[model samples]
Target: MTPSAIPGPIDPPARLLMGPGPISAYPSVLRAMSAPLVGQYDPYMTQLMGETQELYRGVWATSNDATLLVDGTSRAGIEAAIVSLVRPGDRVLVPVFGRFGHLLAEIAERAMAEVHTIETAWGQVFAPSAIEEAIVRVKPTLLALVQGDTSTTMNQPLDEIGAICERHGVLFYSDATASLGGNDFEADAWGLDAATAGLQKCLGGPSGSSPITLSERAVEVIRSRGRIEAGIREDGDASAADFVRSNYFDLGMILDYWGPRRLNHHTEATSMLYAARECARVLLLEGRDAVIERHRVSGAAMLAGVEGLGLTVFGDVAHKMNNVVAVEIPAGVPGDAARAALLEDFGIEIGTSFGPLHGRVWRIGTMGYNAREDAVLTTLAALEQVLRRFGASVPAGGGVDAAADVYRGAA
Candidate 1:
């Protein structure tokens, strides 16, 4: 194929991503990615890496010394945490409530752990007692789960679950990929031994560079069995016979790269590092608590707006995530057709639900850079038009008016 046969230089469409994550990144975050590059171990590059690590410490609400960024998306952070800490034949327990919970179990299985799971219905979260019961029954070495699952738009409560894990002598880990920045996550206070998250969701960046943290205990588990990567292995130290399977996803090696020793791992993704740094910087500048509250209000507005359109909401509302809402697609409306019209005509994109809830609910997100009054109102207005056009009887201006009332009340 000739070069001209390929597409021209990428020109993506302008979109308001009122969906579940990879939402529009903050303009500044995108600009940060375009900054000039530096050599991997250049003093300034390492300085930026260290600064980025410290920034993530604040974002994760942890003081753990092993906090750092994983090179791939949020899933890489999760895989690293599991494969590094969960040895083959170790018993792992996962409390399942949504698709991401199942995802954790799948990853744990691939890591060769003996995985056990107790499930709750979709659109709901497991109670702390339920999780404790599973722990007692499974007596697992680690507990893997997700904090916010975009699939169900549910936020599992972790505070009591963490305490329960401690009582049962199990390591606690959660993928906070969809919840970290715009929702309340207290890694240290809530007793999370390991937490991994991505830049795409509430962090207001693209889907690369996973920020992760490990408690002293979680770090100890990894260090006890971990071998230095072959690339940086020295003559004196011996490599482990059962080292982690994937070198690139090895948190132990990645930590050495991010840690004070500055051991060479892979050449870091420089552009992603800059973007991750900027995402954390922007959120911290706004204040983490402030960001959570902003999402709460914005998400509530979106929820109320959807309700005003005479829509029923999916899920257990009390435990629903603050960054996304699941609206039940109206009975007569063509769900995907309405979605396509919203995208094509209004340049707005709302997500479809996953798994059991697929085609039953439309997931709308007011997350990351799009978590705002204007975004909520704009999406509601566009959604109302699409709903009406598709033969659903939506009240004219109902969505926007309800959202405006929410903003007024909030102010």
Candidate 2:
């Protein structure tokens, strides 16, 4: 294409994402991304990487030295941890509650692990004892879990599972992509061996960067099968008899690169590193507990507002995530049409369910930069309008008023 024919200065539409994830990045995060790049091994770049590691340590609530950023999206962190830890035929038990749980099990199977999955209804989480029983029966090498599955808008309680996993000698790993900053996750205190999260949800950034933390045990497992690239091999250097399956997703090599050794792997995603760093900075600045409380308040408003619109909340309300809600689609309203109108007509984006809940529920999120009173109220108000337009009866201004009541109580 000619220079003239090519599009000029890319401009994207202004959107307010009040959906499950990939919401608007915090202003500081975007500005950080726009900063000038530095060379991979440049002192400044490495320094920034080190700083980011420290900040993420706080985000994960861990003192583990393996805290670092994986270059791809949330799934990269997940795959890295699983592939590096699960040797062929190693038993892995996954307790499935929603789509992401099934996803974890799928990844484990592909990694050549003998995977066992115990499942519950989509909108419900398992009791810790049920998982402990499974661990005893399966005698698995690892327990892969999800902290929050946005598909069901449920955040599984991890506080007790970690202890149970510890008792049964199961390595505990959780994907916190949908609940990290806006929810409570104690990586060390909860006995989590490895925890991974993404930038797009509660972290208030884009989806490219994934922050991951590994405990001493988790690091030892990865280090055992560590492999050095052929180009970087030295005379005395050695690799494990069975090296990691995927070169790109290998956590051992990535660890060396992030550590003081500074061994070359892939060139760091520098701009994403900056954004991830700032996301942690801004999050910590607000105080983790305070940020969580904000999500709680805003999510409550969204729930109340939706109920006021005469909609049913899905699943177990007591265990729903603090950032997203799954409301059942009204009987007469077309779920897709309502979502489309919410986007095309109101410039607001909301999410629909996946798998079992598809076409039956709308997954609305109040997370990241969009976790605010106005964002919640606006989404609710707009949703009410769309449903009413689609021939569903909605009480006028009831949604807004109920949301106001929530805010008033929160204040």
Give one digit per residue, the lDDT tens place, for model 1 in 1-411. 899799888899999998997799999999999999999989999999889989999999999989989989999999999999988889999888988998999999999999999999998898888889889989999999899999999999998888999998999999999999888999999999999999999999999889999999998888777474445544335444357767888777887778888888899899999999999999999999999899999999998999999999998999999999999999988889989999999999999988889899999999888999998999998998888787889888988999899889989
Model 2 local distance difference test score: 0.92
Evaluated at residue 71, the lDDT of candidate 1 is: 89
**What are the TM-scores, per candidate, against the unseen true structure?**
0.97, 0.97
lDDT of 2 by residue, 1-411 (tens): 888898879788889999999898999999999999999999999999899999998888999999999999999999999999999889999999999998999999999899999999998999998999999999999999999999999999999998998898889999999999999999999999999999999999999999999999999998877465684543235534357789998999899999999998898999999999999999999998899999999999999999999999999999999999999998988889888899999899999989989999999999989999888888888988898899999899989999999999989
State in Å the error of residue 107, model 1: 0.6
- Cα error of candidate 1 at position 187, Å: 0.6
Q: In angstroms, how far off is 306's CA in candidate 1?
A: 0.2
- Say which candidate scores most in lDDT: 2
Question: All predictions: root-mean-square deviation over Cα?
Answer: 1.9, 1.8
